[model samples]
Target chain A: MATEVLQQDAQAPARAATLYHIENPEVENKAERFLNAFAAVLHFTDYKALLDSYCASSAKCGRCVASCQVYQVSRDPRDIPCYRSNLLLDVYRRHFTVGGWLKAHIGGGWSLTDALVDEMADIFYRCTACRRCTLECPLGIDHGLITRLGRYILSMAGIAPKALQVSVREQLEGETRNTSKLPEPALVDTLEFLAEEMAESLGVKLEFPLDQPDRDYGFFCAVSDYLMEPDTLMGNAAVLYAAGDWDRWTIGSRNFDAINYGLFYSDWHLERIIKRLVGEAKRLRAGTLLIGECGHASRSACQFVPVFAGQDELPVKSFIEYTLECIEDERIHLDPDIVTEKVTYHDPCNIARSGWIVEQPRRILRSFVKDFVEMTPHGRTNYCCGGGGGLVSMDETHEWRMKVAGRVKAEQIRATEAEIVVAPCANCKKQLKELVDYHELPCRVMGLHDLVLRAIDIPGGKSARQRQDEAALAATA
Target chain B: MEHWLELARGPLFAFTFLVMGLGLARHVLLQVHGLVTRKGQRLRQAPWRRIASSTLSWAVPVGHLDRSTLVMTTASFLFHIGAVVVPVFLAAHVALWSGFLGVSLPALGEGAADLLTALTIVCVLVLVAYRLMTPRARALTRASDYGVLGLVLVPFLSGFLAAHPTLNPLPWSWMMLLHILSAELLLLAIPFTKLAHVVLFPFDRLSEVHWQLRPGAGDRVAAALYGEEAHV
Candidate 1:
């Protein structure tokens, strides 16, 4: 019933309280397609159990209102997580359950009209799917999961947003085979340039090994790292190099990008992407799939890999976890003296929402930085940077993201008064950088590894002047 | 007037109670069947420990006792306690249930039941006022939510007046009829409406145990949606 577009308002928007129309089509049955999608969703899997439970349950307590950043910012009724979820659950109750049948037969009941479809499309996409409400819900109703299910059903009806749809198509079938359209040669060139830049600046040279066989860590970072966040890639590379002899890991030539936008929407894409990734990892005989500083990417892998590949095929490890292990083992020494500024960390919702990667990064941060202050309600209760669930990728929503979506997060970040906000997730980093910039906040937003790249000590690493003198000495000889 | 009370408290009451019991039981059985039938769909073992702990922890849900929600949550907890205890443990309702099925628990004393009933009414009024005043709650509340709250109040209020005959505005027979009828209506509504969450909320956490979307199902979904040539 939620159909209205978000207007500039602090009060929550009311959804379609009464649905009157049912669609009747002569050429194509969109309602039929939606119901078919619903039926297929029910028939092919056990999501029905969840749908049934959520429909029968979901107490409409509005306690989730306290946790939703969007609702907190916009104060629109439509943004309330449970209300947003009700747009889908009400349909389930009306059409799929016996009680709904009675309501339709005895009295006027809701039908899947074009307006309702449009409403679901508009409202479901509006959520960040951070799952903070899941924690707040006394009944444990996962409004975030329901939001994803709504999107999944909508995408099946060919009603997904253009940005998400096009990117997945390109990653699966496009020539470059990654979301960023980063060509292999260009990737190699970028890595070489980064390596050269590091050599010239810090006298550190790390290898960007590609397609090497039987490595221990098959590196899969956000493919965007090749184009945008190069420091994260270099930091991961440097960390891995300093941890081992540096030859035990390789960035597989095939399917190295780990940002699975499928995790944002469609399971078909999630499964397909993971299969391609596992195929690459298996092809390399890599021991573990080492994910870079992307939160959603790491989560989609750590949780869904075993769902597709079973328990024994491959293990997935985040860069944070691996770096923590290295630090613990004294394999990589972080020079605490390098970072002197006040710093705080933003727990990417995907990683820390479930208490998975909460402390590992903090332990790593405290090992180096000075005057680390946590954002209010940090850790598992941490607010999303407002660009989660692939919201940051929609370049069109830049204004809304900064103003409405990211408002609470911006407030939280500003309250901390920390200079550097080390966000580990790709989407969080992009959204937060824009957030801080648009708000004119004093803090700098960067990846956790971006700072770690400055703080880590490389053994036998020469200074830029030493390398310069060597060049001169070689020339003289 | 006596006939009206007799009708509400007798076969009509039995019918509504039966509907609620059978309806809720059917839901439980259907969910179980839904879970068990899917055992063949996938071969993964259930993560029993995570599921068990998650379901139980939300029983108290102390974590949700943040500063903002503390009052509402505490009221909700107390209101629910009153709603359940006053009905089942009341000396009068126990005699009726014992008469029906020859089974009864130790009933609360008359004064205790009166106090709890007053408390339940006060809590419901607080809850209703909160829902009405709070914009977020008002936004979430449909007509059904208000109806359920009103339905809850009817039985408790009417019963209270009936018990303390001195306070009764209506005749004894009318108060009894109102109490009996409203209570039955509430029973009939519980299994079919959002009130079902009273029993079904735990199922929300346990739903993942049946998450057996077998290996090739994604491809099947792709084929079903985007045709056989759809990219996996």
Candidate 2:
């Protein structure tokens, strides 16, 4: 009777919340081959050893379950951090442990079936790899690590989310220079258009320096910002102009996008993306690589650049850090009276938990915003924006992401009652925007630099009347 | 019963300690070897002071456990303290340790040890109830969870019965032997079960910090596997 149940469960297609449709046999075969090859690799041997060490002693305290955003909303036993990790641990034990070895021989141990693989793929991807759970765990069992490791294994099998894989592949091998598939000509035209818009609206001339060699910094941002977040770009350009560091920074012509989807899916992709960033920096001989307000991008570059690029000779600084430094030095003055709306900042999980970039954004916000409020559990303890772990790009998972994973973040924002919520990370902004609409909350999501743009006092620019006239003229054209 | 008590106190006791010592040492050695031989990206400099402070803070129930799970945290803390203190400070255990190590440690008074043992038993019972009743805990709980609880309860119950001989249905010698045998089993199970956290907690926390704060040989390994240049 138990065997029948097991067989039925194994044969049933997983109906759990998943971003990928897994009915294709060709894809399944590819995934199986990839897993087998990955399993065979000696490079992963140390990982296996490490996984075995921590997993065996898991206390299953459920402290991690309370910390997880997904588990908090779904209340699903499968969503529990330890339980999710146990899926992989079970596979490891069944194949590796002496007791499990005997059980296998006696036909009593669990086997890795296709349904198990599908289920594993589904649940592992549900985790955002936020590492908040690590903070609460007594043993500090990093379920985030387990999640990523599981994803990496799944990715090898070609069992990853289609959106992430497509973006990563395009960035690495597509005709376009970046993941947005924007050709260089289109990129140039977009920049020229943005500069004109900035000049007309912000009354400042924004020059996107292309392929300038030996600049002090090479700026990279999410490619989507070019089209989706023109104001954020305008704000960034305005700050640079006001700070008089315009000449020191250049956006690379070949590699303007800093967004690394590889950070979400696989080490192979992560390595490829990191290498491109490094190669671009070296090619330009830029002293520093300035990552724009994208959380995972900032973390990926800061944390993995040294490892992947082989040297931290070129430092990686987040645009938030740069803005804060300008504020601290009084390089750019802000009019505190410019905006009176109550504002709060959302700390992106990658920035706060993984990269320790919590205070810099708050410091920036405190300088200009007269009424700054903090979310109840702000900073490292803050929930994910629901679009984390590349969910923002996975359109299939948007409903689940909004309803389950992003629900806590929505509640946090609602509690703040701040008219404007400043989220520096692009992914967070996307999720928070949708969350604002979905939750029907009276709130607006803006970038940190968007707020900076509103308050910045750009000298020798057009007057309000003249800027309004130019904007009207541009709109007419 | 006398023969069983004598065997538990002598050869069985020695054998359990030997197995425990060897098992724990092997476990520690394996972890150390993995750390030493770990390839790829070099870890970022660890904030030693912060790590120490964080470890100390987590040792108690103050901030580490969430507000929702405070009851379980309190039970866990009490159970751990009682579990360690009752066994080590009991007069008979102290005498055994003194005999084995040639160093005499202070022993708890019989009344105090009995009170602690009883309180500890209650704490374990509370924890077991928490596991059974809480939906999340029940989901996570396995046979090993109940097995570990039983392993802990047997020794404490037996020790309490042996100390207050009037309460036990079994002979005094039999109760004493059961106490020793159960304790031996617990020690033998330590390196192989969830109880390995006794030896692994500090190291696990450190490993987490290393992974989070620093980069490791990811690039080097990738370069070796794929190539020095970007695949594109």
Candidate 3:
């Protein structure tokens, strides 16, 4: 029987809907007042000086574009960061120039009005804030940083979409990271159901240790995988367990979700999510923090957590690195016969483009798949699936999301005729699936962990029952 | 002749008075509008020395001014010297201002003023050429750069030609009028372009240097950038 594990929550609580909204009147009012005051005093000198001193110097080189997946896929002129940033650049010129002032008095400031704010809001949100552009830019002018600041500007003007605002608020208040806010009790029930389903399917009893004390490793996975990406989540567990390292690892019941809200709007929100994960790790007494196959989550662990929360000495490892390390240490062994199809690896932006991580995922992929074809623009320069920067959870921007964000990614996948696409990040997985489906591309999306699980050999070789079953299955065939 | 001087006094007073008045108005408009579009909120007091140095350093070049703002300040210093010297030295402009203000300073001879006019022409050309050539300036340079240059150049060039008075009566008067008109255009452009940076640069530089000399400035820059909460 073909077996499939569906979306399951570990335990959900019965409580008020965790969907948050922009409710702080004080913050909102202050933000609005500041923006209005700022607009009134803007001048050409201050504007140009700012560009020359800070922005121009950093964004001077074009190396950061090498990290964008969208540019890799579509090869479109407008998809690049420089072109997109120029849209904002035009507005600055028209309002601040002497000729601009003269033109405005003659009614030429029409473009500087509210309508342009809406367009800016749309364009900035389309970016995933993955920091891929920073890798290519010579001065390290982080495109992600600028994009976040732009989002803040748009939000203050009331030009931001309600869905994103709501999601950001919810995540800020410690709600579930995913759109579907399944509470604690509900998540617990779902985990129980998955335990039974896994037992029946594989004929092996599996124990998912939650809140286990003195665990050496802190196991963190994306909220999306626990709900929507089942194969990837279970495959992660299976790989760990088969290597007999599962006994040393434990998942926390209270804060198992590793989704970083910093990927969305506010620095405050990013800090909130990372702090929760860190607190959980400390509670479990885990020495090493094992990050699952999520790009931004690992980045938050490796980069933002230390910076924002003042945690410097934590051992953070991505799943790819963890898997590779285990393989190198001779802990986890694989049988390559299981995966017969040709595969091409799609490098998630955070892991491939960001400086902290690289190489491990490709090495792991090489081990399992017989033939791994590289995409036209692979690694750091890969395209965003349009689901980054919290757009996947944002419901209102779905149409624009599909049209503008995934347009390049859809083209990139179509160019590659490979049968399977392996993306590590959960959000990337969702974005890729929808983009592929929308474009009517013929390819199956699989996580790197899922491939590893299939190729990983069970402990002590094949059992007597497995040998008998293979013979019996051969006779039937 | 006294009656003629009185008649010209109203025009001179109106033009100079308006130029001085509108300069303040431009500053007010920029401050109010700039605050409206700004996103972040920071309350900072202006630093005195930085302001003084930047004001003093206005003589430095736009590209590099290692203690001496090199090329920019050099050309600008010449430009200002010409502006001050030519008008005070020129027999015609001094005569006009004296008609209104009832005051007179030592006047240069026609030969000396004419030589000063030629020097002013050279400085204006150098400034315009520099704006066009430098890449940093090129990226920032707009049509206004040329327009402002034209405003100053037209008046100076016409005055130079009109001084000889070889042209017919009507053309001579017309050229003089065109020269005055371009000067007015330049005065209007001064508060608007990156030329406005002339006024803003002093305040910005003062604040930057002031902050740099303060205790723990290095730690603050890193902490602010890295999201560390520690106060430097």
Candidate 4:
């Protein structure tokens, strides 16, 4: 029955995926032939020059390998940045160097066989492409970028995991970015439920306006929020309740999810996801488009979203940054009640190095939690949770991911012995949760807002009516 | 001796003129050709880029890149001492020039050039040693980086030799040519290698100015225009 269910869910999406058309029929044939022809001219190409220019101004030091969660978990030499990059580098050498292509196709260049491709694919997939490695490389090589592009090329060869394909297809369709596609009506109901909960809990009457055209702020949630992960939604509710700024933030009925699978595979899909976030904001007439606590979404929103949209500025802030702003403004008074225990913060890889969102969360954690011990290799140099880079959604590698991908993070958590682990990103939460259960660790994992909600002491805070409204919403679930 | 000096002066003057002229021409080509063809070129032309490229980046790296900044500052607090002392006191470089103009300024008495040369040698060695020792620097260390140390060491080694007479004008001229050639090769490699970061100084600062201007207009428009239904 479980296998049948899995097969049905997998096949359903693949069938739908065929309907929404994006064709480069030539991509397969051309790519194959190009690989064959370019095998000869690879030596003559400026690919190495391009790679070197992109890698860094100087030689890239592999100090970041020490911080990689995948490498830490796997303990495989192939997991190292130098090793992984060199694999791609081999392809680059083969296609660009005379001997490399000849050797790849024939026998002597550098062993470019199908097995090598699979190895490269595995190495690339294991990486969250979190950009943590970029920080430690004194030369500033963003190996994640290369790894992401490598995944894209591999997927073109129809070698991507079945689970990743489903999620990507769902995203490509109008379904949720996670494969747990909540229908539009279900999403509307969830918003209503959150609103009622917020009203009852905080006594601040709010409307989560569905499909509102252009408001002050378009609150974009991760697809997980509307689906199985109700805590992300509830935590968001708790934050909005804590803030009591109903007029300022509005959740869009349309364009709900911000999980761009294209972020995992294709530049085009990435662009579309970014656009949807902005368009939702514009549609709502939102002055600012605030995103929830998801690493890739925020990274996309903070960095690539604006870039892809050709916008001169971001219309919104990542929820963490936005929350920080609110706290700084004295909009939400944080009272340290629920979070009295010693706790450490885990910097999500996307936020740390790629997005450079290192300080804001630390400042927030410092303010909310009493004993905020920082994990080793903290800030822009933090390690990945292994469940990043579309791997979290890819169920095929679940066992390896739980065991190997999260090894570094689990070690970090264990070393802290902190009662609570605060990670603002959703994937971090998911990976940390899986690791906690799998490793049988005592620590709890949560979002920034969850901690804030639990700890906030509303001095003359919410009236009875608001408290009742929040209770009603919580009861409905 | 006079005839040989004449031969050295003519080439030095000619090479300096030719190289500097070419450098200027190449700069123009890079700026102009790049300007006309590259899309989104205007975005780079901001004041922030100018200030950042010119000032911030080099300021930090400069101290780390060479120990002479510290040693020279310590010796001549304001950088004025070495500036004034090295060129005016160096006998070979000054005499080589004066050979053409037919005027020789008196050296800064005895032991002065020797003292400055010794200081330069010490600083270069200390700086090279520092780079070799620091982990971050050591990790990035390359044969070429050391090659640069060796290249800089030549002038000091040869100048010291020429001063004492272990090497006469014949070998001195050869040493001087080697120094000039190495320096020239280093210059050409500047724009292409990590050394090109010296050039990035201006461009890096320029990018900072464009930071306020959103480069994501296309992204937002693209996002809005399509993918209303798509969630990923």
Interface RMSD of each: 2.4, 4.4, 15.0, 11.6
Order of candidates by DockQ, top first?
Answer: 1, 2, 4, 3
Better of 1 and 4 by lDDT: 1
lDDT of each residue in A255-355, candidate 4, tens digit only: 67777666676554566567767766766677877788888787667666545556534565788887788789887766654467888888887767633
Model 4 CAPRI rating: incorrect
lDDT at B151, model 2 = 95
Of the pair 1 and 2, which is ahead by DockQ? 1
Clashing pairs in 2: A31-A157, B40-B216, B40-B217, B41-B216, B41-B217, B41-B218, B44-B214
What DockQ does candidate 3 have relative to the true complex?
A: 0.03
Q: What digit string (tens of lDDT, one per residue) describes model 3 on residues A58-80?
A: 22222334456555454443445
Question: Among all windows of ten consecutive residues in candidate 2 chain A, which has the lowest summed lDDT?
Answer: A1-10
Looking at candidate 2 chain B, the ten consecutive residues that score lowest on lDDT are B209-218
lDDT of 1 by residue, B22-119 (tens): 98887787677767776543534555676677777766767568777777887887888899999898998899989998998899988889899999
Residue B45's C-alpha lDDT in candidate 4? 38
TM (chain A), candidate 2: 0.92
DockQ of each: 0.51, 0.44, 0.03, 0.09
lDDT tens digits by residue: candidate 2, B1-42: 788888888888899989988887877887776665663234
TM-score preference between candidates 2 and 4, better one:
2
Best by lDDT: 1
The residue ranges of model 4 lying beyond 4 angstroms of the native Cα positions read A1-57, A60-123, A136-141, A146-165, A174-179, A192-208, A310-314, A354-356, A366-368, A395-406, A457-477, B1-232
Tell me model 4's lDDT, rounded to 2 decimals.
0.58
The 0-to-1 C-alpha lDDT of every candidate, in the order given, reads 0.80, 0.78, 0.58, 0.58
